[model samples]
Target: MAFFPVFWRILAALITSLLIFHRFSSAQSWDPGYTFMHQATTAPTVAFYDYIIVGGGTAGCPLAATLSQNSSVLLLERGGSPYGNANITDLAAFGAALSDLSPTSPSQRFVSEDGVVSARARVLGGGSCLNAGFYSRAGHDYVRLAGWDARLVNESYQWVEKVVAFQPPLKQWQSAVRDGLVEAGIRPYNGFTYDHLYGTKVGGTIFDRNGHRHTAADLLRYAKPSGLTVLLHAPVHQILFTSRGGTRPKAHGVIFTDANGLSHRAYLKRGSNNEVIVSSGALGSPQLLMMSGIGPIEQLQAHNITVVLDQPMVGLGMSDNPMNAVFVPSPQPVEVSLIQVVGITHNGTYIEAASGENFAGGARTQDYGMFSPRIGQLSTLPPKQRTQEAIDKAVEDMKALPQSAFVGGFILEKIMGPVSTGHLELTSRNPNDNPSVTFNYFKDPRDLQRCVDGIKIIENVIESKAFSSFRFDSLSIVTLLNMTASSPINLLPKHANASRSLEQFCKDTVMTIWHFHGGCQIARVVDRDYKVIGIDSLRVIDGSTFRNSPGTNPQATVMMLGRYMGVKLMRERHATNGPK
Candidate 1:
């Protein structure tokens, strides 16, 4: 065979192998003897099971897999299957779709409503299959403070690491910004490793295998259990519950509509005592709950949604990490594309992990070293109170370090930006209606100030002699000030501007990086066990339950929560009765 043909054949085989691996890895139980019978002659009636899990995405998949080990599990997903779809499993193809596909396209969007768009994946594996795999555990102190039992959370983290099979990228590429850090004197600092914090002047590492991205689908699909039944293309409209006389309400089943728009009800077997766990992510879980009368009374009433439980906190405490892209001219072209420089707490990660304790008790524990001390300090402040002074100090600290010897070949520049706080709200009562997601990016005055501080620090670093050999653009503070003034009230303090002249030069250059989270916050709607407050047999195990947004990619934390919650559910069930 010709060399080109040989290479093509090898590539094709590798892709096929990866797809097969992903499928088998996510399959927890697959019983050849078990079969789903559809009554063709009659209207689809409620079918019973021991557990009903909504949203077969990242968290839901793991939860279903874990629960199905000993119980009859029904995994309901609103979107269609992702397996065997070239558009989904193919990374290059998926990236293209991200740019051109319609916002309503299930394979492309997070949430789209009222002209506002957020990143959401409606396919079988949810965001896990789509996200850039960067796995890091939630801060230890934050987890401890979140009122999560320390032992349980740690065990869950360990189990998650095993299940996800997280592996850091072998090749680390440095960007112009990272070079600017070296010139500015920033050195690579290897902080606590177990906490998954590796502070280098460059970007945070990725989780890839042999140059290909690994996803949650790769993990759960292979371990699919025979006892577990996954129903794809079935969107859950509402959770069905039953009242057991004066006691708390118990979720008994779910009402879902299939892709063909036919409604069906799945009931729990009598005396089997099933529970309904909602892991539809931050956007979907809260939205579904509110539609079923489980949210704020006023909001539900305004939408004419019948109030079921009057849970005021169903959709409250919406939060997310605001991200802005900074472009810098590189002295040389680079190979690595995505890099995360800083992962700050700013109340979101800490509050969610700590469970709403005071900052001292929440993030001030031993695991604090896992994060940038400067970023950690900023996280200590209320989002509104973070000032330029604090941001400047953190930047100064970063500038004082030396560049990594491993990444010395590239000419680096810096891209300093802001992290925004946002929330999600329902636009209509319809299940198909996408919710209104107001990221409120850069709305807070302090958030803007931090970006300015970050930019200034980057400029100082670039001016250092370490980077004198390389040629790059100098982003000035004046440009930040001017851009802040010229931008819209909601999108001001644009991070892309490198100079005051640049800000003036391109007044319409602001854009969003799209990292939204924290709508159905934890502790308020759901307890530490992930069980919905005041509702029995109902739990939420996804990013939506984050008490606050974690400052970095939320995939790892979401998976950890799923593992933790799944184990907790199993343990509790086992305590009451002998193991299955």
Candidate 2:
């Protein structure tokens, strides 16, 4: 009967409820001593810490937790904890989490100078708390190029995985994408593995079976509770320097502000080879560096910041891997899925697929108590108005979902790849404002060409025999530039002007995956050990340290780097009786 499909969906939800109730009953409380908020404004004006790390985000959380094992550590974050936020914890509200423009939302939305829409995570867990939850390791060649010990990186991946990663159950739509990738020439489907391969493979995810998400903040469970002090709503203002006629300006401490407008100074404890580490994501790291007068000489002078160390590449050559998507519509209901399968193109491009919820309780927030009063206060909008607004927004956001209850029963086949680099720079000295980002997407001729090739590869997969059953009368590729779907056949023609049309599409519709990287790097801003070249007792560890985007989802890379830096710093600390 026509109602049978509805009955099955309800049955699934009932089964899922039992699982959720069980999980809630058995869940244990996280370590309490490791966390603090701005309300606990009791921090002394001047406090000493063996390692004072600014930005308790993706890299910061894990790194601070690891480093706190032996030494006293202070971790400061600009955003609140993601632990209790239902919008963040429910995997079903994944899109809503990013679409949320409220300050309280984990993601901070922004537009690049060149008009590319993007966002950054401002929560304690960082990007892992906001991203699409796709997890994959960096390309092996990238690991070797960075001169990182492979064994160590492997161990670091395991450590993060045990806490947050899960094997996604491949359902209908995801399985189709997997076969399409293989049939379209992305051969050798690796069943289930985290190793980066040049074919269709099922990678790990952060969302669990019942759709609960565990963030990098969950890794704090491994922290030395007594040694780690995590202060929320504490944003670092500037890095304090003590020259004392030293050759290199030594970073002695940091000046930051707690939420209640209280100023606090966290200094490296004397007698310990103590230091300050900036793990404040890509944009925040360089901005903080420049604010402390460690960027380009010209920019520093323009901002009236006393030049401590002029590093020209401090905020230059930022690259946000450009992204394009192809939405394939279907009448059949497909189960909701995050990134379960990915196709690694031969030419630095990565293709993945996702399906929207066609099942019951698709409205995650309404069903799961995500209507937070805090979000309305942050957005400065009326409460019900905000709820209604998000619901209206979901109509558009849920298009990639399967067709049963929620609309847009379609399989979203997306492609994101790296090309020429861009830049991220400070617009001003105010840390409260966002930085000036220029993704420079498709600015280079080669980049445009790669995008066209990527489109062609996706088209081939859509037309392949594997996907012949789910025929698409018209394919619409959505970008930041377009409002509605535009057919691929019309966009990519075999006519004389086909090249021109495709080139124009790549230019007009090119958008970013918000996967920005390399505003600061090893040879550019930091040295081999991730220390700023011209500064002493300071280091930068985050996505900014990446020389280039790894051509896959960078969350895994971000967490991996955090884990690597954490383990590496601890080794050096113990070996040298403290940091060098």
Candidate 3:
């Protein structure tokens, strides 16, 4: 009897392991049928759909997928597909896409009017393809502020998680960072979770155990192939409107250009419920609207774009979270890793870190975007290349070094709910050109104070006992702030008083965490349901609708919003026209 029990136990364990392996393998190979996907050059000159979504990005992909279940959808992406793009799918080659500034690359470079370098996603998966892969849901207060239905929000988050989110395995550097955050008094340690909690915790990631990233585009696997059509490299020029002697303008179609520079038009099917949704990112949404003659009268006319509606608030209220970091060099090589651990403080400061030799791989030497501009004389590069250099330079320099001169990792701090705001305006009439936007980082005194407070916490972390081994020397806060070898960019003064130096540091070293949001904000550009206030059958449902960026990373909530809004639109249709 004892022998039989042992044999059964062994058999059960083997079966469970095999089942788990099978599940992951299936997920790895699963494919959404590609029959309906096409290059814009191959698309017909005219197409009609129940809904037309411009920008196949973080929110657009999922929204299109969800809507495809019950209606015909056209998803237009200005960039190429993410499928098989190793720079995007491989976690080790993380910043590769951002560094590739070619016209066809998946990341588009932009320089904010505040003089900060930044890039936006030009791929089907959007920022999900370019971010650090951290995945955490929005805070409870954020959900309430957005006026989202709690139950539906939870359901939508789960739907996205099942296909994309995963528990990140924390290696040595990340584990040490987590301990340091705790030792510095961030809070109780909450192990692996997706919830946005105020403490040092390991958050979910889109990267799998094998280090492959599953992006929002993966959600398309749930889409109905027959009902969805995704066009790659299709840049929408403007939304087309027809005036039937109505009080408000009605959007019925959009004119876009194909990869071959040929024009094409996509229209919504004739139905009271049909709509044109703009799921382009924060910058793109407002720019698209203005390009279509729906913005401030002076700005539109300045660009030679005809004015459709003088919506004065179209390009107002833009903001980006400012980030600062300290580099702790190690005597020994550390394992490569992206963001896995984070410390969320009560005052809305976020602490995170990443380490690995691959992160400092030699291939990125010329990538000004990922490294310090001082490293390769990148500051002297032409304006075009300089614009591509958006992320903080230390990290970028690390990736460029074949053999890193500084074998270490960075512990960074980013302030939340930034009070300072700016706006975006078209620089040219061409839809493909980058816009002139200013986040006006640290313009608000309160936001500057938050940065100072966050830096103090980081200083504590660097001095903590848990982080001692990673420090090659006794580097002071001021010295650490000036650690990077070269740069025309300003650094903290070595002898200034702590108070003055810290505040100045906040202004001088303020780099974007790439979490910019708000332009076409809710109540300003769109209604609660995301419908454009003065435009019938037109909506904007991306991060542009957020007054503040949600969660530590916005991808999860952005993706969830896609599904949530898709379901809401579906239910409304069902109630009005009956279920299909």
Candidate 4:
């Protein structure tokens, strides 16, 4: 065999072996480190805890850990542990986890009325366990706007970072994407920092170098085992409350069902400070609250459910941060990624990318082709001329190329701050039913304009002279969206600037980052301190309480808020207790 052929085979075998190693290695469970993870089947029907926390999810996990340091905390999760679920703990299992529709799989799948497909975690660690594992500290504006103490927020980040976040390694495609981002006018690159800055920068991730995922549940390692008891697969049916002489209703306890469908009652330890906190997500949190009679009184009565608090905003103002993406195919396999490279723009948009993600279908590296040809020099003429040349080249290349090997890369854009908001309300009083969520996206004409701007940005990034050098203009998102056109890449010049066509495309194809928030907002549903406004002994600590969608991935922000809430609750508990 020729020397180059030998080298190619060796490289292929090595890559294959490494991929196999990663798959098996990530298939294993992460040690929960705490010995107290229990199932509802074995737990007691009646339990008492100084603090009863509901929903052991992203926020719930850390909150329980922080609170158990000072109080006997009972953490209840409606799903199983992240451990032993390879899909939840493995980076190679990324797409599989999101697409999982198994009854017991951590991901709970759903589709909206708009025909968009998405899923939420039904597992212990919640979204962190199911999401792409991109970790960026919440934008500073979010903390300030939410009235959170910046000092405490920073401190809380450290509390969670020490357990879950990791600095990711930069490789081929991601590095190329970074260069493309810088070329697209995203600005001065900040190298490998987790801070949310406006520029092209490599940030933190939850996947370690070995492709193992360290989720929020891992933070349970910090839990005081004796003080914290986490019951898995234990879904809370409703918040149990009691009234006091014409005053606001107080959350005293909860009635939840176990994995075996057996119901149990868990109560607060009976101090003025003891409380039940709901850390379920936007949908789950609002759904749970409404089920407990804390929603619009009229809506509850219409459903024939008792109204406890009559708070209209309980399931209002839902924002899921609608997004659109541009995918480019590589000529060879690229390392997988979540969101290592981030481009924060001054415009109301955030551009991020993954090295190995493409939702568009086209000629991939792995596809079969018949012939391979060598073409002459291509031009840098004006877009129309250049696009025609590129389209011709793409057609010629596809027609002649032999069996290929390539990966896909994505340039994703999320609307930074959408004014268009939607809502999530219960489909029924049944706790088992998923709520009806409508993310009334692109309703605002301005939002549509911003999305149009976003598409132009992606087109610019793909068409940049810098990108042209690498043939990055070859198979771009524009070409993919131009699936019906005569020529894919050639159609770019026509559709990229056609704001109306692109806006219509966005309206037709827009999907969410699934960063659902509100439906239980801070000002309208919960107080500044995260306490339910008219209800005592309860708090909403998850994404449900966010005032508005943060610019970036809200996971880090959500976890930070969880820690901050724990610190606040602890201080209040101490104050309620007076002197030591």
Worst 10-residue lDDT window, candidate 3: 14-23
- All candidates in order of lDDT, best leading: 3, 4, 2, 1
lDDT of 1 by residue, 1-580 (tens): 1212232222111111111111223322212232331221222556777888888787887777777767787888776555555434443232322322343344444332222233567766787655544455656666766777878777766666664543333222333344445444444443323363423322222233432444444445434366677776677788877776678777888888765668889887765346888888767889999887788788889989876688877765555443332222223322333333432322221100000001212222111111112222111222233355763453343333222100112111112222445555678866666677665544565555544444444445445554344323343334323322332212222344435543222222223333455656667888766778898878888888775544245676676666677777777778876777
lDDT tens per residue, model 4, 1-580: 1212332222221211111112444356677566888888888879898888888888998899888988999998988887877766777655455544457877776655444555778888888886767888877877778787999999999989988889998876678778888988889988887788888888888888778888888888888898899998888888998997998899989998887789899988868888899998988999999989999888788788888987888888887677776545444556655677887888787777665422124433211010001111111112234344453564344423222322345566888767788888788876657888877788788788877788778777767665554333344454445431211111123343333388866665466677878888878998888889988888888988875766478888788878888888878777888633
As a TM-score, model 3 comes out at 0.88
Top-lDDT candidate index: 3
C-alpha lDDT of all candidate models, in order: 0.50, 0.68, 0.78, 0.71
Between prediction 1 and prediction 3, the one with superior TM-score is 3
Stretches of candidate 4 off by over 4 Å are: 1-27, 357-406, 469-478, 484-500, 578-580
| Model 3, span 469-580: residue lDDT tens | 8765544656556532122232222233333478876676667788999989999999999999899999999999888888888999999999999999988888888977
Q: Is candidate 2 or candidate 3 better by lDDT?
A: 3
- Ten-residue stretch with the least lDDT total in model 4: 368-377
TM-score result, candidate 2: 0.84
The alpha-carbon deviation from the true structure for residue 319 of candidate 2, after best TM-score superposition, in angstroms, is 0.4
Per-residue alpha-carbon lDDT of model 2 for 1-580, expressed as tens digits? 2322343232222111211111233233333344433332767888888999888777888898898888888888888888767667777555556657776667786767775556788788888887767788888988999899999998998899998899988887778778988998887888888888888899988888777778888888889877888887777889998887658888889988877888888889884468899999789999999999999899899889999988889888787777665444444545556677888877756777665533344433222211122222111122234465564553333333233323222222233435567777778876767989776777777777777777777777777777665543443333211221222111112233233466665654455566788777888799889988977899999988886766367787777788888888788777888443
Reference-based TM-score of each model: 0.70, 0.84, 0.88, 0.84
Number of clashing pairs, model 3? 13
